[model samples]
Target: MGASCLTDTGHEMGSISLTDTAHEMGASSLTDTGHEMGTSTLTDTGHEMGSSSLTDTGHEMGSFSLTDTGHEMGSSSLTDTGHEVGSISLTDPGHEMGSISLTDTGHEMGSISLTDTGHEMGSITLTDTGHEMGSISLTDTGQEMGSISLTDTGHTMGASSLTDTGHEMGSISLTDTGQEMGSISLTDTGHTMGASSLTDTGHEMGSISLTDTGHEMGSISLTDTGHEMGSSSLTDTGHEMASGSLTDTGHEMGSSSLTDTGHEMSSISLTNTGH
Candidate 1:
């Protein structure tokens, strides 16, 4: 008399039911009462203790946030204790599209004063602020294209990827995890300026310098080019340089020297073939 339930070949038939029935069907350790769970299906595939229901009825398809509301799936608190209510929520965080918050329980995800925090692509960070694509934590710092607290798992598509230009790839914040104070600087091949030839004829910023030309070509750098930049060499934290036949030079690198005697100066266009 502990608990009872009758099954018709894995199918509930008659008025037979129990407190909690443990039946192994379709590789699912199922527990059925008014709620059928433990199948690792329809979401609730984790350690859950909800008296409602779970609706994990999907498999390796795409990004999903299964919440078990009156029957939230993943790790959701339905709040309302209405019985026999089958309104299940989906919150699957283990998903690799770098799920993050998909399954949010209002307060836990944020607070009751706030709605479900994470779920849709536009719902991750407070959408009222902006259309955030990266992780929610990044929202705390702020972003334009990339996220705040995201990894390759989330930003493997280049949208949130940093421009490996040795500089801090992301915004400085109280919660920026993957931050580098300029290490692997990006190197972009400069556009062929003269003769439409990939080779530099030592005419302008020749690929081959005069042994003291720093041998650096097309690389970005920050050198006081005698131009006397305003207030600061560079107002921003990002790197800059004189893109004269070159794009990137290196750390604070500048033109070697100028032949003051009737020297023929060629024109090199300024360009950024971003990485």
Candidate 2:
């Protein structure tokens, strides 16, 4: 449809229906406004509808799925029932879901994942499939998840940190690797966990760790090893230290400060030494 207009023969087509009817390239350049619909207007940049890479990547509204390379699926969205291009898509190999991830080349994957309205992708991921490689990688270069948010009802609302870590919940991991001021690099639940099944750093159960700054938001463990509290670990300007709190081991690229809110340190260890 090369920019459809009042043809030589003025024929009125109120509903320009193209059901399963395929059209070749050279389709109209579509009015910059995708919603110009009184005349059922359509803008198709029909440049080789397959892998060859179509120059017209902007197929404005209704629904769109890539049929070629140079695809910018992220900028557009699909609403037709099962409108997902790839269950897991990325320039890298490893797939990610629920969790966000990145490659050694610094290619940020699954940058963000969340169940949209319908609660589809509950645990968003930066990577596909949601699981960081089980390798001892970079502080920031290594695979990581940011948060596992939950909607009030508590049915696993949303968690960026929980996606691929395999943990039920996660906070933030401001990394010390990139030049972007600060990034998070702290927790890993790894691929088979529940909300309460994760602990922070050495706890093995997310007993308690730092949430960006070092503040104890929950009850500290009366038993556990290597638990040392820092001077500003529990009390910050925006946050206050409750009674029972735990400090994260400052070893192996861990948090220098942490805290929990209403969380109880059920089974953890705390030594007088600072990791």
Top-scoring candidate (TM-score): 2
lDDT, candidate 1, 148-259, per-residue tens: 1212111111112111111112211111112111111112221211111011111112111111121112222222111211111111111122223333322222333222
Q: Write the per-residue lDDT of candidate 2 for residues 1-275, one digit (tens) a residue.
A: 22222121113212332211223422312122222112222232322221111111112112222221111112111111111111121121111223222211111121222221111122222222212211112111113333443111111111223222332223322111111111122333222212221222221212232222212222222212222222223211122233333434443333334334323333332333344
Model 1: residues with Cα > 4 Å off, grouped in runs: 1-42, 49-100, 103-129, 132-158, 161-275
* Worst 10 contiguous positions by lDDT, candidate 2: 150-159
Cα RMSD of predicted structure 2: 17.1
Q: Kindly provide the TM-score of model 2 when superposed on the true structure, using C-alpha atoms.
A: 0.22
The CA lDDT of each predicted structure is 0.20, 0.23
Candidate 1 has an lDDT of: 0.20
Residue 165's lDDT within candidate 2 is 31
Among all candidates shown, the one with the greatest lDDT: 2
